[model samples]
Target: MNGRFDLNSLPMCGAKTRHGIPCKRKGNKKNGRCKLHGGHATGAKTELGQLASRANAQKDFPDWFFGKPVKTEYVIRALSSYEKLVELMLADEIDWDTVFDVVEQDQIPLEMLKYYIMFNVTPEALIIIQSALDTYYQETHAPHLAFHVYAPMIVFHKFFRQLSAPDREYLANWFKKYSSRHPGYNW
Candidate 1:
């Protein structure tokens, strides 16, 4: 078997085209016809089939963070830094240049936070989310607890405090497990 992967190498459908050309579509072993022709399955077309197809397509998506979609890992880590930077900025200890750099770097989170207020996400929720995310981030170097999970969390935050006790306990466990992963939150 040559390493080439051209149509000539595979078994072709025995059917003929309107122009009398041999069917170039791959044939199924049972009936020698591709799905387009007369293969056993014709693909998902019904409502249930379509829903199943969509669910299969979505199988790779990560689970929601507190019922909110999370930003990518890099954005999350930077946002953790952004949270810390903001505190240092408020203290007026960090230079403006450094503070601006971090803020500019975390554009995704900042923008989401900026406009989310218009949609009714109170600054109070923002405080809780940031603290949680930053804590998770520092603890594991894998901060996913918060930051710009964007619309999902923004929408979910309204119900943040009312989450099931088990979910809250899970988060509490994460904090306990890695409480001092980072050096004392300094600098």
Candidate 2:
């Protein structure tokens, strides 16, 4: 024999091989890979190389590997419905039960409410929503980490409850004013 091959004495590739066994070759100093396992290869530089690299990556991917597949047309329609629902929600501000259902069963994440539930509202409505948001922020004292400093649905319920009957009635009727402007939405 040329020499003794002491496994522990040498640095190993350590990367799994096609047969699911560890490669015995010495690891590259840079990335701990053997030459055949991309140790000698640098990343894609050219546009064509990048495209080829992406294609190679996706070629062996399993079904639904990147999470659920979204239908483009369905997504468009669903967004339209959600926007319409938000408009409708602006109408029934008094019914906290309905509000709870909308937030809970509707499965709309709080992230969705940041803009659509804020600036899209009327100035008078803004005062109401903004006041509730401020109160929620103050009460919770949660870290102002997310885009929405206030997102608790319960806070809105309490705020709406405290509103005068006239304001509630106005919100309950607000949709009627804009419903005609936005037709064809089933929401």
Give the 10-residue window scoring lowest on summed lDDT in candidate 2.
Answer: 147-156
Q: What is the lDDT of every predicted structure here?
A: 0.52, 0.46
In the predicted model 1, the residue pairs found to clash are 137-143
- Backbone clashes for every candidate come to 1, 0
lDDT per residue (tens digit) for residues 19-116 in model 2? 99998888655676678884446888753355456556754332222233333443344344345445545675545454344333323233233333
Task: List the candidate 2 regions with Cα displacement exceeding 4 Å.
Answer: 1-121, 148-187
Predicted candidate 1 versus true structure: per-residue lDDT over 71-171, tens digit per residue:
56544654575555556555736465554455445534544443243245445545543543354446447534333332333444454455567766766
Model 2 Cα displacement at 162 (Å)? 39
Give residue 91's error in model 1 in angstroms: 2.6
